[model samples]
Target: MPELPEVEVVRAGLAPAVTGAVIVGVEVFEPRSLRRHDSASGHFADLLQSRGVLAAVRRGKFLWLPLDSGRALVVHLGMSGQVLLRSPGSDTDRHLRIRLQIEHPEHGELWVNFVDQRIFGSMAVDSMQPTRDGLTAGYSGLAGGATGADGLAGSGLGWSGLIPSQVAHIARDPLDPGFSAPLFLAALARKKTGIKRALLDQTLISGIGNIYADEALFEARVHYEQPADSLSPAKGRALLGAVRSILNRALAEGGTSFDAQYVNVNGQSGYFSHRLNTYGRQGLPCPRCGTLLVRQQFMNRSSHLCPRCQRLR
Candidate 1:
């Protein structure tokens, strides 16, 4: 699954290429990738035709493209979706699940394709309401009452009004400019679940998945099985810092690609995989200690950690 950083990298790559460019055509070779409505195939094609891309932004792991038609193109990469940029007239590959031909007077023709083999990716054209209500509303407090024009009603698991009190039960976004360390600690203090499980809980801290959780826990020298409530305030702060550091580094590296499916728009694997200290390194010597890294199944996901480095309390 593409985490926040990976999704952010994809957003960064597509923003400049598609922004201000009018969508001239749309092709959906696989309809299962559409998540919002049954008629999305036609609606998406019609909405993008001649409509300019105002902006391409990311909220958590979701990608939002504001269009000139007073609507937004909302996309979720799910477990294995990727967006690739191909020059116009370049031979289209069979993996191109959804392609949009964009034309910009200055930049010439560009082809943006969303490719996925698992059919888990989603694409939709919503009148900004679903985008606002679903994804943007999650950041309303951070956005300071600035709601996008599509007028989406805020609705999702653990999402409510713009007040922190309503959103207090929700997890803080590590990428938010106003992410509160104290608030994160408070949330951590309240959970009795394992540290990894707590980190995975969107109600505690949004956007973390199996890969980054293990990486962050390894960085903090905290065991994944450690009870969240038992962590000290300082340790909580360290964990938060580690999460930010790991995510920023991953974004800088263009997002990790464990398989061929995750290549960035330039068709390159994320560089952070080379810097990984613990993730996917089972049976390998630990960088900190010579102890062999262990891999275990937790919450139906594989976790990699150095048993000596990440000692359980």
Candidate 2:
């Protein structure tokens, strides 16, 4: 699944092209992609037609297009999902599941295609509500979000509304400007789990997946199995800094796209994979120290780390 950086890259790439565009039509090649809607494809298409896309917003791995109707179209880019923007008459992708036709006065007609080879991603229409102050309102991943013309009510950005039900449980990611470091530290101090496990907990901190978690832990010289509560204030700060730095760097590089499925809106692969140090560098020499990196099973996924540098306490 795409993490913060990857999803944000797509959002940034999409916002420029899709914002202000009106939905002209929709094509659902596979109804399974709209499984989250609980309704038929006709209704899904009907709800979006003529609606203006105000902003391409994202929180962690979740992406949404805020429409003029107060409701937002929530998008989940599952493990192998790709959202590509192409010219009106371009050849369709073999895996295309959903195609959204939009009319942009300046850019002309365009097609936003959602393609998924594994059928894990889905699109759904969701209701919006206001978030209270700086804290996320309804659920966790639903916390901290992008502000725009359709912002939560009273936030100056617009109404402070948020998409409740589905995303209410996702916590704010560290990259969010509104992310509360004090709150994260307090929560970390209370967790009895491993630091990496805590990092992967969507409800605790959104967006740090296995790959970035390994990279951040390696950079901070913290073991994946280290107890979360055992981290000192300085170490916690270092880890958080590493995460923020890694995410920003990844975003700058267009995110780490090792698989062909992960790409930006232009269908271009990310170059950050070439810059990765620890995620899939097992058996290679550590960049910082002259020690062989190793891989271990973690949360059913493989974790790459330099055992010499990331020693467990």
Q: Best candidate per TM-score, number?
A: 2
How many clashes (backbone atoms < 3 Å, residues ≥3 apart in a chain or on different chains) does model 2 have? Answer: 19
**Tens-digit lDDT track of model 1 for 167-272:** 2344546886545678778878988989999888876677788889999999999999999999998899899999999998988888788777777777667777
lDDT of each: 0.75, 0.81
Error of 1 at 44 (Å): 2.7
Please write out the lDDT profile of model 2 over residues 47-125, one tens digit for every residue: 8989998767677788888788877788888788889999988998989999999999899899999988988899887
What is the clash count for each candidate, in the order shown?
5, 19
Q: What is the lDDT of residue 124 in candidate 1?
A: 78
Q: State, as a TM-score between 0 and 1, how close model 1 is to the true structure.
A: 0.83
Residue 100 miss distance in model 2 (angstroms)? 0.4
